[model samples]
Target: MPGPDYCDVDVLRRIRRRSLAALRADVEPVPPEVFAGFLPGWHEVGRLRGVDGVAAAVETLAGTPVAASALESLVLPARVVDYRPEYLDELTTSGEVVWIGAGASATGLEGWVALVPADAVADLAPDRRVEITELSQPARWILEIFAARPAGVGRFARELAPEVAARAGATAPPLPPPTPAEFAEAIWELAWAGFLSNDSLAPLRARLGGSAHPATLAAPATRATRATRAPRARSGLRSMRARRRIDAPSTTAPHLSGRWSLVPGAGEATARILGRSLALVDRDGVVLRGSVPEGLPGGFGSVYRVLARAEESGQVRRGYFVEGLGAAQFALPEAVERLRAAAAPAPGPPSGLVLAATDPAQAYGAALAWPEACGPGGHRPGRKIGACVALVAGRLVFYLERGGRSLLTFTTEPGVLAIAADALAEAIRAGRLGRITLTTIDGAAALTGAAATAALRGAGFVPHPRGLRLRGAMSRPESVSPAAETTAASGPGAGSGPGSGLESAGGCVDA
Candidate 1:
């Protein structure tokens, strides 16, 4: 682990893996005994009191509010999604609240979202719809415009074309004028691409030729609209739109909404994009080009230079941290600090950590390579949202693919697989993943394999005709499975608890 200010990327990698798993660890913090006894009677019961409350308990939910997914509050942090699931459900699709566009694949604004107050819309509303990214061509062409100027969103591009042409030294005509239909189509592309947007879904509703919201759509086909890729160039605008359904919110909604402005910073557009790139690299702690969206105007070279300058300024550091990520890696100095001090194999048995395969913690396919698949010719598991991964001591142990039908075991070790299986059962019992009905493991029928059966039964899975079924936390009994029943018969310290069955393979942490 000796590596200087930063741990050797090997050690750092292990630390980061565990950190990602713990980023959303399911735990409730409790005060120490000293404070608890010192402040006796501090516990207060009331109707959602503020932090100013005399007791320790405060700012808790006394009731429900609208959310897109019912599990949002129970399982995730606030504002994790731009707006909660279906947050815009009740609002008029064409009124003050609006839907903007999404970034072209991986720009800086992928997960980040913007919101504005109701009255702010009067000043922020687009008079002519913003369409700067495309018209500007190479962003540097009109550096002087975006440099230190918050170009009004409502301003017309036609009005600014002359300055752009003169600045870029272009001898050609100012710009071509498009037919009405062509103009409308171009605007839509920019809107969805997130260069410009408005509060009203009216335009988008018109385009989808039906309900503005995907949830309201009659067909499930459009559910994957965002999966469609729009080309990176302006020339493809017309064909791209005509080629697909272009469902407003489906493809990209719940983006920069309510109120927003273009040209966010007080510097050249390229510089702003570069700075945003640095900010992203800085925020992510450790980042390589693939993880950051700093490749548009100047590509990775620009980002590299900015990071290099930051390195010189002592604002950041550079290294060939992780192998295969190239030498241009940059990380916050504190990240190195954490990398040095953070990880150690815990004293007891390694607990399994279960998170969505796509969760930042499941770095297997991205930061690191996935272990060779156990089954011959078995397709590598995809790191998708619906799929889940189980980890022990920063190493991947299992992958439960979408729909919980296939389980991909990363390890053949009986001990780790048993712990992972018990972790899955704990996840189901906690209602974290709801009921899990897995049909297969390692490409074999779920129940046919001796290893799979022992693991599942140890974790509480019961038989289903198609495969094996485990009830969700809400529907299940106090005990988990036949194995738990046997353990319970042995008395306390055996298997009375939610995750107690893992004792057969050492032990397990409640994932």
Candidate 2:
């Protein structure tokens, strides 16, 4: 048997039939590339899946009514073609087919082709071959130009050819300069590809019709500085125009305000990371205002410092950078008030309790409260200390770690301990920590007591037989009630008793 018919007409007809069958079958429609082998140089004008789809596409292309039956005969294989214009008359007269006319309005065509009746070829020589035209050199040039400076082309909507040519000359493979007509054709192709704006076509067409060469079209005078200065000047002009447009009162719409607000540029990755941390606080509508250390992971410290300085110098940059060391003490206005209320000194003297840190004063305070952990001389052990202080739900929670182990957690208010626990839970969920371990010995018991441990349990923590370890995948409680004030009795270094705890170890304390 003869191999499957690969003739152009047979292939196109099969493509249409299969494509229509796909529509009826509710399967994927055949793509235009399926016909690539049959029509080697022919570019796809449009593809219509079903009879209705075909009719609509043809009518749109022809800009006239297409008989439903004529479209139905094509049967959803409405494979439109772009051929050289020379065959338009022959193809139209010889076919029982839809001829949408050459794509003159769009491509400024050299020729055109159509779906001719298979029988029309009977009179032709058997050996004669139909040559499909490739995209003209100018069209390819235009594509390369668009590919090279997509941003610039988008920015400067008109006068594209020379700018494209000039830019391409700097980097692209050298080719003979295209004529104005060729440039127009290429631009029209680009517009068809949705690269150039449709509105640009009219003026470009007019200019091309008047000019012999693309050079005649008005462009910046070629100079050593033109390449550099022109873009900068254009950018400045564009910026000024944008500003003026913004400043100009909205006369067209009186109800709308003409005032333009400055929106910050795109934020850096560091800003996004910092935002995540801030979001944790912001979600609770809590303000965080204090001097936090610059030790956040992912170089957030440097990002914060840069942003904070920029904010101070009146540079309206993106991200949550405010003035302060590590830019850590920033808060929303509501959070600020909340923090102030939370940190407000009680009527009585300071609660001598203090969270131990590397600082001698704080360590001494901690040692005073818990004499068992301190030496006989009432001096705290000299151990490397790591601390993570976070503001959660309008309260500051401090976690102090000694020798890779969490020592104690101190909170400003009892009500916020749950929020602190939740923060730690979130950290655990993020895989920053394996489990939270809390020991009854050392400063752990003195800082966080039975009441605080209950809060951690409510926040998805399990009291390990050996120590307190948060459950890896515990469901977080919606809300946790404040535990009763748990503080160690005033002792040696206890200058005052502040809220202190032996909260759970591990989890996400060291930021």
Candidate 3:
């Protein structure tokens, strides 16, 4: 008979976890080559890593795609103690694969990123890199400056920092910089825009320099340290104040001054990008067209035909695998098996999980419609940074907005809310939920309703003047300015913001 109807809460939860490799146990480490083979989709580069983004590390190595940090893991001697050198050496050269941004935008941060294998890359008659035509003037100017004189990224950051700063005098300087974490972000954008490319990712695997001091060479960590700390201190590869594009490099930023060379890119690169997107679909097993991300490729429309071909070839199966979407879903035979296998209930009552709202495993906003908002004000959730959803036993309980201050209840069931609250609290206690200080729930005071208060308290939270909070994450006073708060849970916590009390307390803001 046909497989289980395939539209149930258990199937959703299991598939989500399976897609993200968030099963009770951790996924075993796979070589980069093998890992890239099953690459799911481009990860929106930023601090959003848990169960979302491309990857935090390949060791989690499940569905999350490779990231710069993951790339670094394969290189850094300090971090490589866990894996065999040969396993890590798979991509040692620039030839095996190439990392490029989806070219979603020349400015937007949603430049989904991924690494494509060399053979698929070579399939394009011209090339596979995503093409960019909407490049911002500033990014174009910066590219010109660098093109004229290829200097270190640090030097470019330093030069552009002042110019960008002067322009910001008109307003608040747009997205203020000195953000060193974005150094890799800028490289990501440039790579996608076709301004920065190398035959291999070798530049990241090894440090590069020209006329550098012996002391600077001796301390690679020092340069990276300064780069990371520069947003507050002011030095090292600074992100552009305007945010999406960069012009100059900050002083002292080292390791990538002259290593990565510039490239012209293919005239029309959609074929390669589309090919890779389909490749990811096969590897990922089950894929929704929307899951590929908009604007990553230059064009579309041939997906059904391609899937039909694959089906005829016995390469993939097409069916109503997921609920709440059009009937155009496709899955590999193995993916269907795994997804059905995932239908079984977990041995224990679900502990609950808080993962990135955009995490691919979450089918609500992507493959299915978001649950109805239960409270007064209508709530719509997006796959945004710092935004998260809490689930208990595959049921979406609540959605946390970006700042983490406001929350939307997906289910009004008091019992479900209680378990969800407990899960959130447990995650916080274990430091896995990140630091959240809920100010509002269902648009009302998060601690206002009796049920909410009971849920909060039952889950180990305390009634704070702000709303509800866990002592471990919220008790400590914050020192950073309101403007510097970030949304990456793996980063720091929020400090202050625009509202009164908890509203201004940097709700849901990641460090």
Instruction: Quote the RMSD, in angstroms, for model 2.
Output: 33.7
Winner on TM-score (2 vs 3): 3
Model 3 lDDT tens row, 26-145: 222222222211222122112233221222323222212322322322112112223332333344233444444434332333333345443443332223243344554344444555
| Candidates ranked by TM-score | 3, 1, 2
lDDT digits (tens) for residues 351-437 of candidate 1:
665655543334565445577667653346764434567766566777776555557776678887788888778766665555555
- Residue 420 lDDT, candidate 1, scale 0-100: 84
Show the colliding residue pairs in model 1. Answer: 68-85, 68-86, 98-199
Best candidate, TM-score: 3
**Which segments of model 3 are wrong by more than 4 Å?**
1-194, 197-220, 224-249, 254-274, 296-300, 429-434, 471-507
Q: For residues 1-511, what per-residue lDDT tens digits would candidate 2 score against the true structure? A: 8878556987876776665444323322221111111111111123433334333332222311111111211111223222222222232233322222112222232112122222221211011111113555555655555566534223222334455444334444644345444454555453322233321112222322211111111222222211212323345333434333222222112111111111112245555444434432332222123222123344445435543453343332222222122224333344334333443344643211111122211212211222232212212433122232222321224343421234344442455666666655654543323234444323544334554565566767654333345533332422222321111222222211221222222112211
Question: What overall lDDT goes with each candidate model?
Answer: 0.43, 0.31, 0.46
Worst 10 residues of 2 by lDDT: 35-44
